[model samples]
Target: MMRFIKPFIMPAVALAAWGTALPASAQDKGPIRIGVPTAIQLQIGRDTQTGVRMAIDEINAKGGVLGRKLEMVVADETENPEQGIAAIKKLTADEKVDVMIGGYTSGVTLAQLPHIARSKTIYMEVGAASPAITQRVKSDYDNYKYIFRSFPINAAHQARGLVDFISGMLKDEMKIQNIAIVGENAKWVQDLVPILKKGATEAGANVKLSEFFDTSTSDFSPLLAKVKDSGAQYLIVILSHASSDIFVKQWYDARFPIPIGGIDVKGQDQDFFSRVGGKAISETVGNFAVRAPLTAKTLPFWDAFVKAAGTAPVYTGVGGYDAVHIYAEAVERAKSLEPDAVIKELEKTDYTGVAGKMVFDETHDVKAGPGFVNLLFAQWQADGKREVVWPKQIATGKMIPPPWMQVQ
Candidate 1:
C-alpha cells in the first residue's frame, strides 16, 4: 500500500544554475522543492539527507502534494552559521523551495531563522536542539510562526529527562553521585548545563567540575586529567560528532576509569562502535530519538535505511523522515501550497512518525513526555552493542559499567 518516488540529489551549483533559469516571478510549477543541508563535511548532514530522500520517495510515489512531485535541493552548511544562512538564502531566494528542513547544529539553525521568517517559506527543523528556536516564535508569533521543529527536543525540555535519568538510574540505582559535567561550548549545551547542574544538585548529586570546550577541541587529555583528579564517578557529556569520537578514543586510550554518559549524538548512531573502534566507547551511554523496534514505525524504516545505506537511521534521519511526511500531510490536508494554509495544517498535526506521537505545542516544538516522543537512554556494551537502558517501558536492558569501571 506504500508508494515511493525515485531518489535524486541536486548539488548546490546545479541548483543555483537551475534557480537562475527562472524569471523574476518564478512561477510555481513542476516539482515541489524541499531544500536540505547536505553538509558533506558532517556525517549527520549526510544521515539526515538520507531520511529526507526516503520520505520524499514515499510521498512522490503516493502522487505527491497537489499532483507535484517532491524534490530536494541540497547545500552544505558545514555546521557553520554563515554557511547555513547562505544555503538557506539560496534555497529560498534562488531555488525557491516550498519547504526547508534538516539543520543539524543549533547555531547554524538559529542563524538561518531571520531570513526564513522574512522569506515566509515553511521551514521544519530536523536536528537543531536549541530551545530558542520555538521560543523565538513564541516571542514574535506574527513574524516567526513559519518555523517548526519536527526533530531535536528543545534543550530546556530535554534537561529534565536527562537529569531524571541521571538521578534515578545513575545516582540511585548505580550509586553514582560525584559527577563532572563537560559539554561543547555552544548555545545549546550552554543553556543545558545550568539546568543540569540545578537538577543534579536537587537530586543530591555532587557536581565535581562543570567545564565546556569548543566543538573543535580534539585533545581531551587535559579534560580527562581534570576529571581523573576530581575523582568523579561519572562524566556527563553534551557533544556532537565532530569531537565525540575523539573524546571517546582519547578517554579509552588514557584509561580514565570513569563512566561517560549524557547527550552524545554520534555515540547513538548504529555505526558508532565500528567508527570509533574496539570498545573505546564501551559502556558509554546517551539519549537519542528513535531506535529500531521501539515503535511500529521504527523497525520498518530502520530496515529500509540499513538496506539502502548499509546502516540504521540516525536521529537526524528519524527527524528528516518525519519532517517530510509531516510536510506532505500538511499540504494534503490544506489541499494547497499556500504557506499560510500549510502552516495552519502543520499547526494542527497529531501524527505518529518514526519516533512517536508528534503534537506541536503553542511554540511549534514537540511536547516532551512518556506518551510523546520521549528520549531513550542507551548504553554501548563491551562487545560494541547498544541497548536502551532507561524509561522502563521501552528499555531493552539495564545500565552496566564497563569491566574497567567494575574493577574501580
Candidate 2:
C-alpha cells in the first residue's frame, strides 16, 4: 500500500476535471493514492513518511478502505513554499491522488493551500501550526472545504496551554518569577512569540529578554548570557529541528541556571539525549504535538512504529500515521472515493486514532479545548527519559524542576 515514487513522476494532462470528484463507478477500480508532498530531506519529513507508511501497511493488511489498496506517493518539497506548491500540483494534476497528507512547516502549508483549493484535493495537514490554514476554511468553507488539520495546535491556543502550565503549575511550585523568550526568526515562531509574551505577562511573569535568532545560528552564548544577566529563571525556547541541538548543547555548556521550556520540537526526538548528552536536556520542559501512552491505542502504535522505523516516532510522525487512518475511515464511511463524498464524510469525522479523538470543527481543524484533543506537555528527567506531565487527566508523571530552578 505504501509505494514510493520520484517527484513529478505523474504527468499532468487534464485541467478542467481537476476539481470535480471522480465518478462513483470509476472509484472502485484501483488503489487509493495518497500524495505526501513534504520536506523529505529533513528528519521530520522522514519520520512523517515512516508513520504514513506504517498506517498504510496496517490498513492494507486489513483489506484497505473500500476494498482497494491505499498507496502513498511522496514528493520532496525541499522545505520551500514554491517547491511545495509545485509538488502538490504534480500530485493532484498528474498522480491524481485521492487525498494528500503532509506539511512540516507552516509557511509551506499556507503556500500549498491555494493549489489544494483549486485541485480540490482532500488535504489533511498533519503539521504546520499557523491558525490561518483552518481560518481560511472558516472564512470560505465553500472554497477551502477540502482542507483539514490533524496536528499542530494554532498559535494562540498553543500559547494558552504553555501559559496555563507555567503560571498555574510551574510558577508556584518552582517559585518562578521572571522568564525570557527565545525562538528562531521563522514566520510561525515570529507569529507565536508575541502571543507567548502577552500570555506570560498576563500570567504574572515579567518578560526579561525576548529574542529571535536566525535558523542558521549555532552559538547561543549571547542569548544565554543575556538571560542570565536579566535575572530570568526560565528560558522558553521556541525552535524546531534547526539549531535545537546547538541551542541545547550551548545552554548546557554555558551552565545557564535558568530552566528551559516552550515549543521545543527537536527535544521531542528520541535521539535528543544522544545528540546532546542526556544530562544536558534533563529537566527541559516543552510541548509536543503528540506523545505516546496518552490513550489505549497510542502505546501499541508507538511500539510497532519503533519496531518498523528503528526509532521512536516524533510528533510529526504520530500526526502522519493518524492522518492516513483518518482518510481511510472517511472513505469507508462515504462508501465512495468521490472527492465530494469523502469530504462530506470527513466533515462528520468523530474517529480516534493514535493521536487523539479527531473531530473536525467548523473550520476543518481538530477541536482543542476542555474534553477535546489537548496539547501534550513533557519533561526530560535526569534519568535521560521523558514523560507526559500535564493535563492531569493524561499525565504520566508530575512535572519536576531541576534543583537549580527549584525554590531555595
> What's model 1's TM-score?
0.90
Q: Would you estimate the TM-scores of all the predictions?
A: 0.90, 0.88
Instruction: Give RMSD to native, each candidate.
Output: 6.6, 6.6
lDDT of 2 at 34: 87
Candidate of highest lDDT? 1
Question: Please, what is the whole-model Cα lDDT of each candidate in the order they appear?
Answer: 0.78, 0.75
* TM-score result, candidate 2: 0.88
Among the numbered candidates, top TM-score falls to 1
Worst 10 residues of 2 by lDDT: 9-18
User: Can you list the residue pairs that collide in candidate 2?
Assistant: none
Mind giving the per-residue lDDT tens digits that candidate 2 earns over 252-363? 7766677787787777778777778765454455554444555566777777666667778777787888888778877877777788999898889876666567788889
Clash pairs detected, candidate 1: 5-57
